[model samples]
Target chain A: MSYIMLSYTDLLLASLLLMINGVLSVIFSLGLLKRLVIAVTRMVVQLLLVGSILSWLFAAPSPFWTLLAAFVMVAFAGYEIVSRQDRPLKGFWSAGLGAGSMTVASMVIVLLALTTQIRPDPWYHPQYMIPILGMILGNTMTGVSLGLNTLTNAVRREAGAIEAGLILGMSRHKAMQGVIRQSLRNGLMPLINAMSVMGLVSLPGMMTGQILAGAAPQEAVKYQILIMFLISGATGFGVIISVLGASLRLSDNRHRLRLDRLASGNGK
Target chain B: MLEIVNLHRPGLSPVSLRIDDGECLALMGPSGSGKSLILRAVADLDPNEGRVRANGDERSQTPAPLWRQKVGFLPAQPGWWGESVGDHIEKSDSVLDLLHKLHLPDESLNWPVSRLSTGETQRLALIRLLAHAPKVLLLDEPTSALDEEARKSVEALLKAQLSNGVSILLTTHDKKQANRLCQRIFHINKGVVTEAFS
Candidate 1:
């Protein structure tokens, strides 16, 4: 059987359908037109900038340049995660370190383990490494931010109980166990739900993209399964590290909750 | 025992007060007299320019969590830290007994907090705090929301707890309640604490 490839006109019609759908969504939604416009504009600008950069990176892929670009992406994502919470720059370094380490480790491991036959020049392949690392780091960043917020807020809200526990001969760490557990659950819920509904409720973006790029349906499905599993693992590890690391900054040497500093917007 | 030294608000003279262990000290003052501020400062719930020590340990030296646990605070309007009433009580076994003593039924554990009357919620909050068994009890108009009978019952229950070796420091605008509940009274005026009666 021969497959009929879509012509330029068909592509144009497809693009127009997306635009019309967006417009219709904006019209039917209440108080969302401005937000929709802003989001669309932001997407256009960001994609255009990234498109240019990726084009250049792919044209001349060097190890040094590729690593530098990845570092830059991680740094920006780290800053964004911190800035989004209106938190201080204190956690910026930690977040950057966490994101950088996790993304690079996962990307390298997956690439080496799966795509070892790709080529001799493997570490800096823009097509495979960049997109995969971007997805992993982006999800990890979100997990960190969510975990951090949930942990901090939980500690604050339950400060009284925590104190009660401490007075009852519980150690500081023991007192914080509840908050930590709750934060972990809250952080991991999205990833868990996504995993639960992987194929039934929605087609994941990576698999959909791979299929659209003409990969076999079976191959795309396998990759999707691998990526989702990896993402969940990365997210879990990232959230735990971020929470534990962030908690260190929130207490004093005596293991007391340093509310004065964490509060009053100083941590931000 | 609790002590406050140089506790002063802006544009006011320093105020000082000391309460012995197991003593019920009533703080009485008009509005804006800074009575509540003293209770908050002692509880370490407010930032202030003063020194507070619980059982001879300075605020900074003592662990705040330990201090807070030992010091039960009932604010004028209690704030629930959880979504449900049962969530606050599920951690311990004595919460049921306290709830019963406070005249709240077992079914109240499942009732949405929004549905509770101010008086009932206040009682529930008191019971919640009491379950922790703090060494010092700080009451900031704790009975302000209750009816006359409820107020009397609460006062009697608190009076009975004096033998439990807990220090009680309270603030109230009601002179009659103050006379009935406290062995000593301190009147705050413009941030200055003065011994009004003993």
Candidate 2:
């Protein structure tokens, strides 16, 4: 049995349900009413744009278009991570390093999964590769942002501790070992927690999406597990790369912390 | 010998002084007089417009990490990281005997850094500093937290290090300790320096 498709009227009715939430926010004076409305509007607009692009790409099924869409997604993911940092690196280094690391890590993981495990017909099949790459990149971006945030803020706060280590003959990398380790752990915590709570507490988004689209439960479960493994691995790798790259940028060859290279305020 | 040529920071004047081998020079000053700032500058931990040299070797001639290792600066309130006291001390075997000299037991190495008292942490930090056998020791109130007995032991250990041809630059608020341990004393007030005696 295939999933029922939502028509324009059905979507309109579903959107009306959001009015109840808006009314409640207004009645309770939550101060989030405006933000809620703007956010919902943005969600609809952005999803429509992406949906339109995906429809066109799916119909054509060209390797070029598939790669282009993937690149765009990764670019936006990188930008999101950079904009989320509190003490982000200065100028292009902030966006460049973050995007570079995530792109390298996620692309490598997704390609490895596609070429080795999935092995779909034509090898660059849009249907298989796009969603897989999207899931991996989306999750990896969050992890990288967490790692970057933790590293920068922790280094600033623990400057004394790190300086102490540097004064003791440690190389710059060696001096930052403690903070880097903490940051990486923090970056991976969400993925680890999700893995722990899978199926027990709540069904994951990917699994639910698959089930709603009319895939068999067992098949959906299998795909969900595979994607989870991909995401976990990608996030772990991406976070490490981002943290190391960012930390290197923060220090100099003489093992001194050059905090001036970082901008003052956190990014929004 | 240690030489400071026109060392200037925000609050510190262009202070210049020389500390000969096996000599201990004390820096006495009121609070916020940039005493520790001078020490940090000399150690290459802060940005300053000046020069520092040890035994005719300028700090700029060497890398910052190497310079810092050679010219160790112990802050007033020591900064400790890692799980245990032992983790900070490199080449533990060579420095194992020095622990007893500072009244620290062998098992103290296994104790968590969180478990250490302020005095103990200071002493351990001193030992950690000595592990590198820096040619010049820039100490910022190393014994400020110690009691009379612990202070005596630390002073004795420092004096021994001095006797072995190490140059020392130390800061203290206590005039007695300065007179007792320092061969020369320089008083700093409002970022200006005046030599009391040599």
Judged by lDDT, which candidate is best? 2
As for candidate 2, its clashing pairs are: A86-A266
Clashing pairs in 1: A87-A268, A88-A267, A88-A268
lDDT of 2 by residue, A1-268 (tens): 5998889899898999999899999899988889999999999999999889888887878999999989889888988998899988989988887888899989998888988998887788888888889889988988999999999999998887888887776788988998999999998998999899999998988889889999999999999999999998899889988898888988887787778888997635
Residue range A1-268, candidate 1, lDDT tens digits: 2235767688657656556656777778755657767886788689879989899989987778777877787778777666555343243444553455456545554465346533335656776678877877777777777777787777777777665444333456776787888877877888888889889999989888778878888988988876776677678877787777666666544555555545334344
Worst 10 residues of 1 chain B by lDDT: B8-17
On a 0 to 1 TM-score scale, where does candidate 2 land against the true structure?
0.83
Interface RMSD of each: 5.4, 1.5
Q: Put down candidate 1 lDDT per residue, B44-154, tens digits, no spaces.
A: 655456777767778777776667777777777665545678766664568777666777788888878778899988898788778778778889898999998889878
**Model 1 deviation from the true structure expressed as Cα RMSD, one decimal place:** 5.7
Which of the numbered candidates is closest to the native, going by highest TM-score? 2
Q: TM-score for all predictions?
A: 0.72, 0.83
| Chain B TM-score of candidate number 2 | 0.95
Chain B TM-score against the true chain B, candidate 1: 0.91
Whole-model Cα lDDT of every candidate shown, in order: 0.72, 0.87
